[model samples]
Target: MGRYRETYERWKASPEAFWAEAAREIDWSKPWDRVLTLEGDLSRWFEGATCNTCWNALDRHVEGGRGEQLALIHDSAMTGKVKRFTYRELRDKVATFAGVLQRHGIGKGDRVILYMPMVPQAVVAMLACARLGAIHSVVFGGFAAKELATRIDDARPKLIVSASCGLEPGRAIAYKPLLDQAIELSEHKPEACIIVQRAELEAPLVPGRDFDWKDEMEKARAAGAAPACVPVAATDPLYVLYTSGTTGKPKGVVRDNGGHMVALKWSMKNVYGVDPGDVFWAASDVGWVVGHSYIVYGPLLHGCTTILFEGKPVGTPDAGTYWRVIADHGVKALFTAPTAFRAIKKEDPAAELVKKYDLSKFELLFLAGERGDPDTIQWAERALGVPVIDHWWQTESGWPMVANPMGLERLPVKYGSPTVAMPGYEIQVVDEAAKPVPANTTGAIVVKLPLPPGCLPTLWHNDEGFRNSYLADYPGYYKTADAGYLDEDGYLYVMSRTDDIINVAGHRLSTGGMEEVLAGHPDVAECAVIGVADALKGQVPVGFLVVNKGVNRPAEEIAKEAVALVRDKIGPVAAFKTALVVQRLPKTRSGKILRGTMRKIADGEAWSMPATIDDPVILEEIGEALSDAGYGRKG
Candidate 1:
């Protein structure tokens, strides 16, 4: 809190000064002629500065005698194996992997798709691309064959890497088999499909198409090339991260090489308060941008000890597994989703034994996946004896926009507000006409000007798509489809997506708020709310809940209980019309509940899924539940 308090005051007092100070951390080929010059839509930061971010991240730090320091702490739950690497060790590993890529004909600007899980080899592949100046696109490990094929078609990488399957919590989804299926469909099968054997639960590697990962690594070591950092421009494409396909097929958000590095490093330091020697863990799959930015880029660039686990936070081992790992590792600062937090908090709090370890070493607890409810924030504070700092950002933003800046914005355990925009960001809540809405009024959230380092330059292979998605709807600003407001204190309180907001009897409601309340129920495992159209009023909220195993009750009874909880917690205006209890919520491949899809089902419309959802069958069950509840029954 002390660090964050100082940063918040300093940044708020003079943002330009705050950002200028942070910019000095970047390895600039030449100092900026101006820190930033804003004229029209062109807001250039550190104009004239040039340098490869890879140099700063991998080379410069090691060259200066941090070589032997631990850089990554990678583990695989499926295999019960762990690999620890130092900066010096990684320097060589990256070289070896880069050499293997060269042997496979991967080179500068060549797209390489990595569809592997959060194993050490995955990070090796990422750094290998950095070493060779190749563009790497990481498909989330959970993606099905069709989704994998879609991204493969879009990127057309020279090489693809995967294990036979992906393991999360209780199940192992066969990744190599899925990749094989994708390759069968793809006209352009990557020239070489590399296989890594992580979970020995799978069969032996395919003979011709697959090579043993250890053998490949050994071969690269036998024929070594001097590891050279890729000479990339600040504007060069660093990564192409696909967002959760909310509107249509997933759009690849292209983040620039240097800018992304700069933004991530700064945000990790200032926003998340990541510190050297700290064990950082963000429990998100590699497919989503948060997973890419926090789980991989920012923490690695900052040289923090990052934990990359290949299984679910709550896997077959149970919900207590995460807390046990935290206790075992003595992790100082942990970043995770509010959805996960709510679930973990529901578990026998007595079983979440932070006291088993000396948890006093920890100071920061970060939450994302919608601004957490106040109860969640307070609950975390009480349970962890640490403040639960919430954050809000999108795939296009590259890094966090509104965050409880570490060494800066520390607040009491209140929910809803993410935080004020960090230094160099111009955030506003505007009405439909693009006029700035009055403070405390919910409106369209937008970024008014050019941002700090790490913003996505464009969408992968889609210039018009980029313009249409972010810039077209709003004349000049970046429109965050989520509706939110700023209090007089200047802290921004973000809600779920605009479509997720329910206007019940003309009273506005955020689904997050209602879901948070529902989560307090012992029977609920997870829940999603959607606004169904009302003939007279406008829209009323309806909930679809996934009941926890072993907890069975009449839907009507639970529905009545849910309404009372919301009415008491957030007032009567946020009332729900119906609560359809189900076994699972409709979620995308990335685990984001598609409220828009739920909304369609609630409205009795034929469901047309966005491209991201791996499982479309859950919604059918939900619809069945809804129909049984008389959702579509005519009087």
Candidate 2:
């Protein structure tokens, strides 16, 4: 703890010097004229610098005589395939693809969208764009054509790279057909499309706009075409990643070149505690931010081996898939979402399969992408016998804002909190008027002016949207839109979204807090809480729960126990009265609970269905359950 305080003091004293020193670790083409500059709400680091992100990720290591080092390890349980690529091989492939893109008239500042699966080609596409200074936007592979059409119309890419099909546990999803339909539906179409034929899935090819990906690469290699790295300005755009908006249309978060490179490289050693040649695995898809930072750029920049696993946590083979991967690859650091653990715990509560593997090499496990409830955290810690660190960040911030720094000093684990803010982030809890509140008070989370290096600079083509969404409410702070409080020791306890707070009889209550207590019940597998309209109180807490399978317990009995557990843990002020057993809770594909949607459905209000919903049928089930409970008026 003292070590944490010491590091914080050094950073708070002189942040510009602190970050400038961190930037020295990267390989720069030319030095910057200024270390840091701020204008109103925007920040620029390493102004006037020229650097190529692809060169730092690939060429630098190969030039340093570490070309033989392993750079990528891809293993897919669905296809039973294993592939490895060294730094030298990766650089050559990137150069070849860069040449191919150039031949199609895609040059610097041109937009190219990549809609491929979790294969090695996705990484190559991203690096190829970075090599030529082009901007690449990758959409998740499983999205429908209507969803893909909106992105195509927004980005207006000159070219698109996609695969023929994607393989899941029990089926093969056709991607080329999806792309075709999306192109037909979109108003703005790309000039050409490149397709990787994986399983002979036939797709209609337009007369002069579609080509085979492998054939183009072969032709480029045969002609001895190799594209050199193009130097980009420090403030140039690196990539635009759209958020998985559960309630609205997605926003493109734009990340810059030099700052993103420097911040990710520094965080690899300082936050994750891994170095060159270490094995790091983040169990997420390439479409997400974690995959962008950890799986692709961060590990490669550090010359480490990153595992890209194409399998689900529970179904790929069995409940032991994650354990098997860790043992097989000797993974040193593992990162995933807490919802995964909840699923595994539901299937195997006693952890019988986990005991079968040898996990001596596993060092740490990280949980992100949602709030980590205390019950889930304790279960993971006890089951794996390792520290489960819950870090917090957003898509806007490329990397972690608050984490327990394993490299600096490991702090004592707090069951329900993401530890202190990382260096270079000034976090504060404030009321509605933008005034600071005392410790142990719940309020909106805000970050002071001059956000650190890796944070988003602005929205793509929508600078006004960026200002109104993040900076308008707080004069000099970036509003996180999350409701949380800071403890006496400076630990952060993220309660829920601000709208998720329930105003019960003029007292505020966090549904996250109530859900955590309900999850402690012996027979409860999963639970979701929402604030429903009540005549007596302004709002009241209602819980929807899923009991463990094969538990041989009555639904009514389990609900009574859950209510009793909440009453015993949290006092009467919580206003937690009712618990209804349900089949499942509605969630997005990324595994976030749809509490707002649930609340609307329970209150009999019309709501727009979110685009990212995992299963729409679950919404009907929830509505029926609510109707059976006598809250059935539909408006």
Candidate 3:
């Protein structure tokens, strides 16, 4: 009867009903005849449809009385200032940028690489590309020059977008320096780069090849031509996101328009419970699918005010940066990773930063990225007096599957469920054979039918790569490769990744379970527990840690307490093979620690394996600490 019920019914009535209905809410020059068509192994939603996602998300919102209302709130971490952009203002900016692309022969289906910080304009540029019907590939802002260049070469985008200066944890890095390097690597770099000037850093403008973003916008406006309407089908490519390749080269995962729009718009309303006036902050960089969905397209299409803050969550002056922005903006919903929760919990728990901000304004606190430790969620809820939601999804599936329900959070968290496959998604916990697993039994988490938005259609340039990585592993079902068990209530509790599980004497334990134990300790700030090769136990868990900044305890003592904490939390079998406290954990830019690298460190090898780690130094730290502990002598 209401928005939630109607939305649920609309989805349940038919597999493709929800997206078909949502499509009507947007502007369409031409609409599809059928909702979905399944032929052979392929499924298409809104087949033969024609519409512009950017027009629905931005331009139409400006025309629909919500134009003057703020749609994006920029909370600058480096400057400690907040900037607001209204729907109308956003539309104009996007139109201007789209115009810039038009001037450079950029049109429908062209690839554009947005390698910039989490500033407001970054989102603006992304939407602008969408408006022009171009496929965007946003490289993680923290990626070194080499990583950025790799993606640039992969997509072969015609343009590379960067800020004159961008925010980093401790200080601003000269972004153009990296942009220059990426340009050198880009096979299809534009004749001129568009710089979203920020940080007030001195312009290291590459002579004759870079253009001021603001000035270019003025030029586009002065020409005053009608916005170009590039002909594109509804199912046209929207983005190509690159996930870290477990093998050598990263794979570019491509997502189509119709599915992305429907899945994200619906998830935003039902999952985050995003409302018209709500200020949402998906504290993820634009590089990942999370940013593509919640941060950019989803929130905008829902007609909500969202935050686009640039800088690290922990050290933007202090650990309180996230809290301060929420209070200042009265952000109603927040989505971040467990990595941040565990990492920040290492800071002064009762510091004045806690007392300085009022988090009561936020209605929902959501967790994704990695397993949401029940321990972390509970502490955050208690400290902030708000229910914390933990959701689970992947780069491949595109949209959230398991999560705290956006429109139904009051139902009470089931502690580890991703909230029952989300409404339109068909999620299941299955065995190695891809058959459904019984309740309370751990197995692979898989999606059944009708892939949701934010889900990649295929690997950017490789079709079989997508099928092999996601579809081929478990035929007929998109195997997530994450292990989990569904509770009696159908709540899915994701264990760590399949490789992240530990089997010792027939007892299987998740890294999350061990992490929950390590985090429960009062002295422990943050830790990583990885299963390592052990001839006796088959495989055992080892703890690598970063203690609180000023803790006077010696490394050996911290390691001792860490093991005791793990033992107490689970059982004696949870003991570490070798516990080492390090200066920092090696993590991807997204805050996911490189556990595979940790596993290598425990094997007493040189840790020279370049398989999973972005940085090789974290392995070195583990090696030095292990050497000092005399673990080798004990062997």
TM-score of each: 0.90, 0.97, 0.92
Which ranges of candidate 1 are over 4 A from the true structure? 1-20, 29-49, 199-210, 246-250, 349-357, 503-509, 516-526, 536-538, 545-555, 567-575, 608-617, 632-635
Q: Give residue 217's error in model 1 in angstroms.
A: 1.9
Cα displacement (angstroms), candidate 2, residue 262, comes to 1.2
For candidate 3, lDDT tens digit of each residue in 386-409? 778888888777777766665754
What order do candidates take by TM-score, descending? 2, 3, 1
lDDT of each: 0.73, 0.88, 0.75
Q: Compose the digit string of candidate 1's lDDT tens values, residues 15-120.
A: 5676667767777666656656664554445555666665666677688788888887776666677788888887788778888888888888899899887777
Clashing pairs in 3: 270-406, 270-407, 271-406, 391-403, 398-454, 398-455, 402-418, 403-418
User: How much is the lDDT of residue 441 in candidate 1?
Assistant: 90
What is candidate 2's lDDT per residue for 385-451, written digit by digit as tens?
Answer: 9889899988899998989988788988787888989987899999999999999999999999889
Model 2: residues with Cα > 4 Å off, grouped in runs = 200-202, 246-250, 632-635
Candidate 3 local Cα displacement, residue 454, angstroms = 3.9
Model 2: worst 10 consecutive residues (lDDT sum): 243-252
Question: Which pairs of residues have clashing backbones in candidate 2?
Answer: none
